[model samples]
Each structure stands twice: as structure tokens, then as C-alpha cells.
Target: MDARLNYFGNQLGAKFLKYINSAGHALGLSSLPAATQELVKIRASQINGCGFCTDMHTKDAAHAGETQLRLNLVAAWREATVFTEAERAALELTEQGTRIADAAGGVSDAAWAAAAEHYDEEQLTALVSLIALINTYNRINVIVRQPAGDYVPGQYA
Candidate 1:
């Protein structure tokens, strides 16, 4: 399957993609743990049904040595025992963040407080930024009907 438009081939999209990529780069330098970032991205992508992102993030996580059990359990993270408390906090935030429209209050105070319990201000900033970034990517991919299952690790980098 082909993208409706090749983002790189279109001058406007190419320019837009530079800013898009910058967001990813910004998170790369953040203190948010790499493993957490991957799980967040994968979970949000799953929630958003963004095939492009789900495939990319899952592959990236695997290449980074993330365990298959952990990756597979992300969708059911609330019931999984494989995650740390911090990872659980991050996952909870990711779910609420991705499903913002599903709740009237946005992310619940409990979720926010829970994330704060695990992450310092700096890591919190990164986690929030990462959630926002992956959501943006998910929306873009879903909107464009981008096909999945072909991403290679580091292809975007």
C-alpha cells in the first residue's frame, strides 16, 4: 500500500516533517527512560489504532532489548504484573492522555498524582512531552491512512 501522499516527496510535507522529526529528537534528549518512552509510544499508538506507529514503536522497543512479554502486555498493562510502579504510572498517564476525549476531566488527578509519585519534575516533563508527541504522530498517521508493518528500527532517525 502507498501513502496517499509521500510526505518526503511533497515539499510542504517535507518542511512539515522537519518540525515533526524535531519533536522526536527533543524527546530523545529528555531524561525519560528509553524503555518507558517506547512503551508509552506503543500504547498510545495502539489506542489510536495508528498502525504505522504501533509497528514502528514495537520494532524499536524490541531492537532496544525490551522483552516480548513486556511489549505484549502493554495493552493490558493495568492487569499485568511485569511492570514497575513507575512504569505503571507512566502507562496510566499514556492511556488517559491518549483517550483525553473519553473523559471529561482530562487526565484524572489520581493519574497525575500517581505519575508525580514516580517521576521527578524533569522526567515528568519528558513523559508529558513524549505522550503529546506520540499522540501527534498517531493522529497524523491515522489521518493519512499510512500503512504499517514495514518500518525498520532507526529508519526515522
Candidate 2:
């Protein structure tokens, strides 16, 4: 399928993407675990139906040594036995955060408590920021109908 517009080539969109990508870089430096970061990114992309992002993040995850079993099970994390408790909490938080528009209330207290149990304040801060950043990328890519399956790991690095 063709995209509605060429977001990369457009001057305005390119400028916006550059800045947003910078925000992601800042979050990448946060205290959150890198494995959790990729899982959150990939999960959020799937929820948002942002194929381009899913492709990018999954490859990035694999390149960083993420096992295929865990990657394949992210979408079914509630039933999957692959993730740790900490990772599960973060994934739950990512789901509620990404689907905010579909629910009246935001993330559940139980979910927050679960996350708190696993992550320190600094890590929590990074997780929140990463969630927000991935959602932003998802929206942009979905709106522009960015094509998927051509991403190379660390292409943006």
C-alpha cells in the first residue's frame, strides 16, 4: 500500500521526526533496562498497528540479543511464560498507556503497583518516557501509512 504522504522527505515532517527521535534517544539513556525498552517499543507498535515501528523495534531487539521466543510472545504476554515479573509489569503498563483513548481511566493501580514493585523511580521514569515516545512514533507512522519489513537494525543509530 502507498502512504498518504512521504513523511521522511517532507521538510516539515522530517524536522518533527528528528526532534521526536531525539526524545527517544534521551529515553534510551534512562535507567530502564534495554530489554524492557525493546519489548515496550515492539508491544506498543503492535497495539497501534504501526507496522513500520514493529519491524524497526523487533529487529533492533533481536540485534541486541533478544530471543525470538520472547519476541514472538510479547503480544500474548498475559499468557506467555517467557517474561519475568518485572517485564510483565512493564508490558501491562505499556498496554494500558497505549490504549488510553479506549479506556476511561488510565493505567490501573494494580498495574502501577506491579511496576513499582519491580522498578525503581529512575527506571519507572524511563519506562514512562519510553512508552510515550513509542506511541508518538506509532501515531506518525500509522498516519502516514509507512511501509514495513525493510528496516535494518541500528539504521537510525
Candidate 3:
């Protein structure tokens, strides 16, 4: 299937993506754990139903040596026993953050406190940034009806 628009071919879309990719690069250098970052991305993408992102992140995680068991369990993280407490907190925050509109009060204080307990201030900053950033990507890809399953690991890097 073809995308509605060739985002990379369009000059304006390319320019916008350049900045978005720059922001993503900065977040990658933050103190947040790499594994946790990928997990958060995968989970948020799943929740957003962005097949392009879900395909990309899951493939990226696998190529980075993440176990299939954990990757598959991300969607059902609440019932899974494969994740650490810190990861669980991060996942919880990702869910609440991604579904912000669904919950009238936004991210709950309890979720915030739980995540704060596990992550440092800098890590928290990165987490919030990552969540917001992934959501943006999800929206773009979904709107454009981007096709999935052809992403190669480190293709953008």
C-alpha cells in the first residue's frame, strides 16, 4: 500500500522530520536506560495503533538483543513477570501518558510518584520527552497511513 503522501520526498515534511529526528537523537543520549526507552516506545506505539512504529520499535529492540518474550509481553506488561520494577513504572507512565485524553485528570499522581521513585530527575525528563515524542510520530504515521513491516534495524541511524 502506498502512503497518502511521500513524507520524505516532500520538502516541508523532510524539514519537519529533520527536527523531530534531532529531538529523538537527544533523548537517546539521555540517562534513561536504552532497553527501557525501546520498551516505552513499543508500548506507546502499540497503544496508538501505529503499525509503522510498532514494527520499527519491535524490530529495533530485537536487533539490539532484546528477548522476544519481553518484546511480546510489552502489551500485557501488567500481567507479565519478565520486567523489572523500574521498567514496570516506566511502562505504567507510558500508558497513562499516551492515553492522556482517555483519563480526564491526565496522568495520575500515583503513576507520577511511582515513576519518580524509580527514575532520577534527568531520567524522568527523558521519559516524558520520549513519550511525547513517540506519540507525535505515531500520529504522523497513522495519519499518513504509513505501511509497515519493511523497516530495517538502524535504517534511520
Query: Number of the top candidate by TM-score?
Result: 3
lDDT of 2 by residue, 1-157 (tens): 8889998888998899889888888888888899999999999999999999999999999999999999999999999999999999999999999998777788888989999999999999989989999998899899989999998987778
Candidate 3 residue pairs in backbone clash = none
Residue 6's lDDT within candidate 2 is: 96
lDDT of each: 0.92, 0.92, 0.96
Name the candidate, 1 or 3, with the larger TM-score value: 3
94-127, model 1: which lDDT tens digit per residue?
9999899999999999999999998999899999
Provide TM-scores for the models: 0.96, 0.96, 0.98
Taking all chains together, the TM-score of candidate 3 against the true structure is 0.98
Task: Mark the regions of model 3 whose C-alpha exceeds 4 Å error after superposition.
Answer: none
RMSD of each: 1.1, 1.0, 0.6
Which 10-residue span in candidate 2 carries the lowest summed lDDT? 100-109
Sorted on TM-score, highest at the top, how do the candidates line up?
3, 2, 1
Predicted candidate 3 versus true structure: per-residue lDDT over 30-147, tens digit per residue: 9999999999999999999999999999999999999999998999999999999999999999999999998989999999999999999999999999999999999999999999
- Model 2 alpha-carbon drift over 4 Å, by segment: none
